[model samples]
Target: MKKTIAGVDIPDGVMAQAATDLIRGTESELMFHHALRAFLFAALTGYRENLTFDAQLLYVGAMFHNVGLNAKYERSPYRFEVDGANAARDFLRRHGVAEREIEEVWVGIALHTTPGIPEHLSALVALISAGVQMDVRGARYDEFTAHQRDEIVQAYPRESGFKKKLIEAYAHGMEHRPETTFGTVNADVLDRWDPNYRRLNFCGLVLGSDWPN
Candidate 1:
């Protein structure tokens, strides 16, 4: 049966499990935790208004954005972004997702690592994913230090009550951007040895713990 969270129906259990497995292979509990956190955050923020196609697409995209990490780590290691996207595309296809949705998913996975994509749901997911990555690394984006956040605010500044609603919805999640930590490490040190360690570490911050369960 499909699992629903915050009103989004996740269609395939097998694919979900596959995604879980891929994230788990990172061996970083923190990475897994923050990844899920980002997904939840995306779902909550993206669905604030009517669930448009773009928003729905982003919700799914955020869920499986990092599904390629393990495979990427095994392959080139440094190019986890590319590897993870390819792996996610394959996994999505294997799980019987439609071609068009798969393409959207691919685009989301690919651009999540890079900035300057279009300002659609994929781009939004990419930005939020980046924020989540920052969280995993024990970093925070305050009003002053958040250049990207400032850009986003400028691009979508509150001009009207409706815009305020939208920004409020986004802010509800974005406001919880993680803070720095020096006392404790959440994931195993061995997991940090991968060539994609930096990326995975950031991801770990976003994902938190409680993944692959």
Candidate 2:
């Protein structure tokens, strides 16, 4: 049986199992709902772009993209993005998915929050990043009809304090490992929560270059 959401037919066999369910269950209501909306937006973006992609792969990428914010992946030495990326890779491997396909999902989640590149990359990866941006910051909000936005939100309500909760989750996921957030949006969490957190300086690196320009 195929699951339908906002007129998108989720790919038939990609995500139907006890393990996927168990992994998804780890996120909070907010993250879970956000995941659904992410998929909708990703699918919508793909449709608009007229790009052919593996819907199931996009679904799985968006679905597990935030698992790093959960307790299981939060403690890993790797950055939260990599943690989620690794989790996705491990899950697909366990399910016997093709190695090449698994790598696509891995790259998608790993670069989901990475600035700039994901958008120009594979459709599966691009969709996840675009979806997340539209959901979080309303990037290209005008591209989506009001009805479309309302319907997706109705299905996955963005509860009150969602923004605050999101920040808290990010902080919780990376607080003890502040070094990992240095170059990603995850840095904001540390900046807000840990007063001592300092961002790296680009000019300082240029000035200190071993070979003077």
Candidate 3:
């Protein structure tokens, strides 16, 4: 039984289907689940906010924000923002979404991983999605090579301190090392992983818009 959070019901079946679609031919189910959880977290958080645009569009944007992470990572170094945006455009069009709605979703997906996106519901989704990625990676920083950790630190230097703190909190929560559980996906993953890591990281990055001194 999967759990619900912020009105987003994430069941095992839904996650499994998403994972199957995401991983496709990959062996990294853990990565797939992490990305899926991040998307759910983003959608839930974005929906809980006050937005000027249609909430359903935000939901759709969040659901497909990272749709291209795996495929893009295979070709290049985690260029999910660009690839994901393109993928979302096609996916949304296929599902009969309007052109305007598709554009909003594409904007959300493109800016989700990168900084400098305007402050709006779509931007919120992107911010939350990055936070989700940080949560998953922070917990298992040791699992990642030194180079990978350095890349994350470089990519998000503005939030490095807060991210370090959040990672520390995550480490404390997981007793210093978090392990991934296979064959199942649940909200506990978010509870244990904690989106607050992303939340704080986003705050730090957004508030400190000026380059790190």
Candidate 4:
């Protein structure tokens, strides 16, 4: 039976179910629900915008977008976004998904945290970011109806203090690889949570370069 919410049918294909099970088993309850909600929100956004997308691909992207935050990747030198993207790539490959489709999911996950560019990409890529931003940053909140909002939350309640806790999760994921946060939004997480965290300034690097201006 396919679960439908907000006029969207949740993908339940074998690959989709396998991907869901993987995340549900590995992620914390809060994060697992967050991933599901992100998928619903993204699907609804695609419908509203009249964009065509592969719901399965979007589901995979949503489910794995934050997986890198798990303690397993704490020592990785890559940005959490890239780690999550690479994880998605490996999973899709194991399932025998084609390289082209896998790359779409990879870009969707990798760029979800980027501030301004995902929306300009393919519908699949754009909706992943849309769903994540809608859930976390409340981006485009007014675009969805109250009914849509109410049902998604009722289906997957946001844990208390989601905003603060999400920030803490981000901080925890990146604090061990502070160098990776440079030039990305994860730096904001460290700024808020990691005491003694010093942000790298791009201009400072340019000016300090051996090539004198």
Query: Which candidate number has the best TM-score?
Result: 4
Q: Per-model C-alpha lDDT, please?
A: 0.46, 0.82, 0.46, 0.92
lDDT of 2 by residue, 101-151 (tens): 999889999998888999888888889898888888888899988888988
TM-score-superior candidate, 1 or 4 = 4
Q: How accurate is candidate 2 locally (lDDT)?
A: 0.82
TM-score of each: 0.48, 0.90, 0.45, 0.97
- In candidate 3, which residue ranges exceed 4 Å CA deviation? 1-3, 11-27, 52-63, 71-79, 118-213
1 or 2, greater by lDDT = 2
lDDT of 1 at 83: 50
lDDT of each residue in 138-200, candidate 4, tens digit only = 999999999999989988889899889889888888888999888778888899897899999
Supply the global lDDT for candidate 4. Answer: 0.92
- Deviation (Å) of 90 in candidate 1: 0.6
Better lDDT candidate (2, 3)? 2
Which pairs of residues collide in candidate 2?
none
What lDDT score goes with residue 109 in model 4?
Answer: 96
- The top-ranked prediction according to lDDT is 4
Cα error of candidate 4 at position 112, Å: 0.8
Query: For candidate 1, what is the TM-score?
Result: 0.48
